[model samples]
Target: MTSTAASPPILQFTDVSLGYGDFTVLKDITLNVARGQVVALMGGSGSGKTTLLRAATGQILAQKGTITAFGQDISALSAKQLQAMRQRMGVLFQQGALFTDLNVFENVAFPLREHTKMSEIEMTKVVLDKLDAVGLRAAAHLRISEISGGMARRVALARSIVLEPELILYDEPFAGLDPISLGITAQLIRDLTNRLNCASIIITHDVPESFKIADHVYIVGQGKLITDGSPDQLSDSTDPYVQQFLHGKPDGPIAFNYPVTPAFEQWLQQRKS
Candidate 1:
């Protein structure tokens, strides 16, 4: 939702609950991403951080409550309307989901070619500029297979912001990078969030890295928001769930094991006898 007129939130989820078929992934999620802010959604695996990103980008509709983007209700939009809305936003998947058949330049140019009537020369300039932003302009001709993982992620980042999207959604942006690459990627996220002045939501399990890049953070657990605040506030929180997650503890308010029958343990022990 690219709105230069006012700095209202580019993305908002109000009392939203989203799910797949019979299983709910995120419940009662009320969050907002105003322009120039980078918000991180942090949680353990299967805790619905990625699901929240999916909901924010309209990949899934809310089963309950409202998911709004660009100042409009996502659930109310038609298919065509939703597609148009998505064009104004950008998404970077966990794996650099570049086209296997296309080189770096073409991958970044793909969106401009599909969405705009810009001339090839103009498109080339835009693509190069984005590549430069992520320090990948020199590797513009490299195929996905030829580049390192970090370079691929940088290319993906370039492609995501090529269109100057008002909002960007990043899913596990630091998933599989070396220490140096991880640091570089984290810095890029912080720089781009401020450079583009765009609202962003980063969904990641990497607590330290996410905190370094995020202006605000929300922690989720069992389909619900456990807590939210600045990095320091979250670190200083007394909430058991927040403490458990930040400290990487095995036992706390959130149990380590899934529900199971108490008698099953004894039954297995008896059978061994």
Candidate 2:
């Protein structure tokens, strides 16, 4: 693992809070991602992991504190400036989000075509190179619908890296894969981050896989950062929440049922009446 202690971080969040209108989902969050690092953001469903991604991408502004990406305050960037900054980043969404009508090669080439003025020949070479990196070069001509789910995901990975982004955000990269494909994807994520010398933040619940590739890990719950450290450090944690989450215990700091509201109780009373 590379030490980022001597270098400035590529992305930083200082006491950040994020959410939709009138509701803050995560609060007082602080974290940083440095070049040549892969940080895993782990949490249960509805724990605001994706909300952090939205704030990072400028899809939504932080409700409080600051978010600095590539040394720029994303909240303060002008529309044109934000667009330019976004071009330096790439996102692999949970479902791959490929264009169903486009073939694998074209899917991977979409970002290059949209952002650069390269000729068709140049675009083809770039797309094929990225596809080859993901071990899907031969499937370049296959339609999106004709490939397996894992292949489609690889195509999405190729697309995300075709531009060679400085920051890569992966949202549930291993959500729906068999053991073999899952392991392959995890290793690929680590290899690509090292090869690109870029910063990566993976938001996933797959503890074992994420830990294998992650240099750092942050666990979120109950609207705050529960804890953060290296995978080994987290594994040694005695914090009840951490133990429960890491070991998949049925009961602990995390509850199996959602909290009930006063209105819900009143409604139940009225129904009984």
Candidate 3:
């Protein structure tokens, strides 16, 4: 389905609370990814950015509220229906989780083979086109072990987009990358979003890079949204926590202490007993 500027969002989450079992990692989450928009989820580690991605993919049901993707409410979908919906979405995992048993070409070709009955010639052309988009067509025959970290990330990106999905979810895409590779990957993501005219949700902690490419940004902390706005708005925020995070300050609203009994008090109590 093609989307225009006025079309409804391709993805939406409304008051969603997500986590496993008894603990909630993200609460009252409301976000959307419109066609041709790049939305970045910014937070520190354990702030539940990746959990939101998982909820969007229907890998985990929200503890409360609803998640809608491709115009369908995810919680209402049966297993088969959810699986079908997921076929239209692509995901680039945090670690570039490529298939070790497959070479670069085969890794990118896997989705095409699994989802479509394209002929061998057609599949080869499509796979090469995707790999070429990520600047890795020359290394098509190389083993996963033979590629550098940056190259492997490119291959993962290629694999994710080979099917030409309408939505792409990137989880920690810039994690562990050097400055040069990080910048290159960020540009590649922005270019792909524009070229394909698809919506994207990026889960990341890199503030400057996220602000650089994002059409909208949502900052989360302690399982709640801290602020949401355009890059400029966020940059100009006066919220103490937002200011600290944006400037990479050592101290601010966030506390470093773990929620545990005070050590000196515990020792005194034990001695008295």
Candidate 4:
């Protein structure tokens, strides 16, 4: 990611409603990430965190409202213009999502070669530098499938920052990672955002882990933003759903099988008899 600067927002989503066909997965999302801050997006599964992330980076279409990135109106940009705008975005999907067939070095170099006219020799320098930043320079030639999960995540992190993008979108960066791996990943992300100075939006359920690094936090539920504030505010919130999610409570306004309660009860009674 680019080095930090006290710049204006690198990404802004204004009343955005995003989805496919007629279903709106993310509705009226409004948030802005200025340069040099890590904004965490928190919610339960199906809360539209991933959908919103995709929209912010111009990966998914916005059916209504506007999305701006790198000072360009992303929803209004042409296909080629959107592609150009994407050159400024870096994304790390859940579980790294590395190409299992490619080696680490090639995986990281893929974007550089595809987007730029740089010679292979120059591209190697960029790839190696990015690998070094994520402490994976030694794993360059290993196939992505050979690396441990944590290592793979780090490799993906390396690739995401290889372009030195102005904005980074990370989905579930801590999911399924062990405690030690999570610590390493968390510190690495914190350092990278600080050093690169790029804006970041992290989608995660790891409340404490995310709060440790986040400058701001927003939560989504029931197709809308449920709460937004700094880590402290969210942690102390009295909002029933937000509190239930943050604390991992079993019984709250969010029902576990409310939609299927009648069917479940019928089956349970039959088994009891």
The Cα local distance difference test for each model comes to 0.86, 0.92, 0.89, 0.84
- Give candidate 1 regions above 4 Å deviation: 1-6, 258-273
Give one digit per residue, the lDDT tens place, for model 3 in 202-230.
99989988888888889988668888988
Q: Against the true structure, whose lDDT is highest?
A: 2
TM-scores of the models, in the order given: 0.90, 0.95, 0.92, 0.88
Positional deviation of 171 in candidate 1, in angstroms? Answer: 0.4
Off by over 4 Å in 3: 1-5, 257-273
Q: How far is candidate 2 from the true structure (C-alpha RMSD, Å)?
A: 2.5
Estimate, for each residue in 1-273, the C-alpha lDDT of model 1 and write its tens digit: 123335687788889888787667778988888888888999888788878888887888999999889899998999999999999998999887999899999999999999999998999899999999889899999889999888999899999999999899999999989988888888888788788888888889888888887888998896698888889889999998998889899888876664343466677889999
Extract clashing residue pairs from model 1. none
Ten residues in sequence with the least summed lDDT for candidate 3: 255-264
After superposition, candidate 2 runs with Cα above 4 Å error? 259-273
Point out where model 4 deviates above 4 Å.
Answer: 1-7, 257-273
lDDT of 2 by residue, 89-161 (tens): 9999999999998999889988988899999998988898999999999999899889999998989999999
